[model samples]
Target: MRSSPVSRCRMHCYFETGSPMCGGGTRTVFSKRRAGSGVLSPVREGSTLTHGAQKGSISNYEVYLGALVGTLLGAAPAVLADNPIIQTLYSTDPAPYVWNDTVWLFTGHDEPNSDWFTMKDWRLFSSTDMVNWRDWGKMMSVETFSWASADAWAGQVIERNGKFYYYVPVTRKGSSMGIGVGVSDSITGPYKDAIGAPLVANSAIDPTVWIDDDGQAYLYWGNPNLYYIKLNEDMISYSGGINTVDLSSFQGHFEEAPWLYKRDSTYYLAYAGHCCSEDLRYSTAPGPTGPWTYRGQVMPTQGSSFTNHPGIIDYKDGSYLFYHNGALPGGGGFTRSVAVEKFEYGSDGSIPTMDMTTEGAPQIAPLDPYARVEAETIAFSSGLSTEPSSDGGGIHVTSISNGDYIKVKGVGFGDSGAASVSLRVAAANGGAKVELRLGSRTGAVIASCSVDATGGADVWKTISCPLSGSATGQQDLFFNFVGGGDQNLFKFNWWQFARK
Candidate 1:
């Protein structure tokens, strides 16, 4: 399938809506001209470029020419991404923690076709721009906790005193459910069971941990009820007894997943509220253990999932809410996907109700096209998976078939324009061609490079291809794969574009 030249030209105008070339206005239309014309006749800036413009008003030739000029002049359009940030896997119960400029996301991996929350492991991913997330792969799983038997459910990790601690709920032997703590020296960990047993067992789940300004730490978790514990300096051990907070003032049914944090001396507790199909709600207190006051719903009963988990954090001067829903294809209550939304708090430090959106969050900054971008770093992807390279290095893209593509959004090519693209690829099979498209799957093909087999899949090689079309400005790049058979085509490690 391919977009008609006329439609492509119209899209180009739409993409350039808010640029100086278009008078920093809305849509602009070019005057009509014959197809295959060498030159683009200029139309007045801010002219309305509708799809069904009257004949002789905006010619298809002018539209195409405008696109070409826009690209050559380094006026690339910004591509905004939608929700369900991770496409290659089903993620749920998002737990985001900021460590050194990047937001580290730890989520429950929902097994495909799961009928009843059959989660067995957790996944870790991180992002600085929010739009492009780098997959860190499986961080820890059921086997991580030796004493625990099954159910690697929702959890939260915190860094303290040069050590990282993860609190999660799992099924303990001879018990229904218990919360366990895992400790590691690094944030991304092969964590060890800190306390060879459940830290606090009471048929509870969904553990959220937070540390206060005065060097005190607290762990909160439970479903249908809320519990808290004061941890000692070691973090793995707690001195105080488990205390349950009074939820009589909470607006809705307080279920589980308590996210505790502090801002401006006020302590906030956000949790999944109401029954069955859960919505997010919160309460505030003057102290960590509160004489709490119910604030109200943060997110309403939306998204297809029956239950919801909340992870809230403030990063890069913006507040964000991370949750899960059955919004992906073949997703449901059991099989869910994680998503995020940028939000604002009320004037009084109270959280306002936020709705779920496909457009999750805006990019913090544009991606530099000249840098060596990992193939696994993706804003959006289709028909592909990532794995550790066999050469004992960083991650690489795999499970690629014909029509498989990876979309890197907001790539800024600069004014000079990119002359060529370089890729580190490997293929045991014959080889394949990667078509570089802009805007959409059937959008304009700017470049195509045939990757040659490097004798084996693990045998790596560098390949370069000259870009044929305009490659300037900020545009969403689509690396579309095409091959002869239905098997794997090749593996891509990293890619970058060089300026002319």
Candidate 2:
């Protein structure tokens, strides 16, 4: 088998909204704060460290020394991320597009606790530093296409003529898998179906789109065989009939997930090669449609998932390869997670073999903490979920419980330091504190602000608290949740720091 056609699976499952598998919960507002207190332990700062009054205090000198000591000891910077980049949900089939200075990652959402590929919608996540990603939530879904019934499998997005177009494979009603195109004015979109019907419908899947310097666009996709169609300037339609790639002329077993990119003058086609367990392989051509010469493996078969997908792009003088793996807790073939690796092509323009890792690509630059940062923007998170805010402000972090934490890696607090921080939060039940910690989750508490009920979980409030210790330079910032009771604590919208 070239690759398992997920749409061909005999079994399928769909969960209703707000189910346990979706991590849904109830919310209620309380006037009184819950009865409980937690010990606030600051990093050792001689005798200056104090813990009480729902706040912790530490010395500025110690913060500086700790940073210096960590640097001297060669401690891995928090900016360096762990793999399976997405922790809040299972995101698969990464399609990375570089627009302006940010990398916009479009992926398909794998439903939780699924026995088979149960995908309904597509998601969008973007990052400036590539370590901390802000979830843009659902960009589009099968619901967007009235004619499509299921299989929001793999898709790719491209920007042309200032408009963003998404190409995805969906199961057509009473028919086989057909490709659909979505278009949006903004990169972050509420995309609409560009064409009411399948752009092309021969049971082909995993659509990857690329445009050449000559203003000609190409859409490539298929399994068991390879095919391409020259897309017109409109993007919603094609210029000619479907064309097939001569698989026999090309080297290697080209399974599926065809990613097309042009490096200088060479056209490269990277795909999932072999079956049962897939590895990444590529072939190079002098032109867009190839007499492709087999280039060896880009990534060997590894990770927990049996199937693999590839998305490659170059951003900010660096080359990155994005792929899917079942590396997260409870992750498997049907519930896959997307991970990225930084790699360099051989001087001859051939790709080098890369490995999937927990410590994913390093932060190209530190994140600016002074700016307003969305709570859903995370490098790593534990015990929390994200959903659309009731205030119509995109997505917010929800389902927060005691000990839940969101880590923002490589946060540059700067030399002047931060004086205080304000958080946009909502709480149904009171008795929760957002602890601002540095370095490690347990490293040191700089500020701990108690959150009170804001009338409803949907009713948001902004609370500001002073920072007791100096938070300067580049550091990994952890928003550690501490509260009493097992019920949901609060919902986090966004946060920003005030300069000292």
The candidate scoring highest on lDDT is: 2
Q: Which pairs clash in model 2?
A: 83-358
Q: What tens digits encode model 2's per-residue C-alpha lDDT throughout 285-393?
A: 9999988889888888766565689999999989999998765445556667788888888889989988665567889999877899999999887667789888666
lDDT for position 408 in model 1: 81
Task: State the displacement of the C-alpha of residue 220, model 1, in Å, after optimal TM-score superposition.
Answer: 0.2
Q: Find the 10 residues in a row with the least total lDDT in model 1.
A: 1-10
- lDDT tens digits, residue span 239-277, model 1: 969998788877545777788999898999988876545
TM for every model, in the order presented, reads: 0.82, 0.85
Candidate 2 residue runs with Cα over 4 Å from true position: 1-81
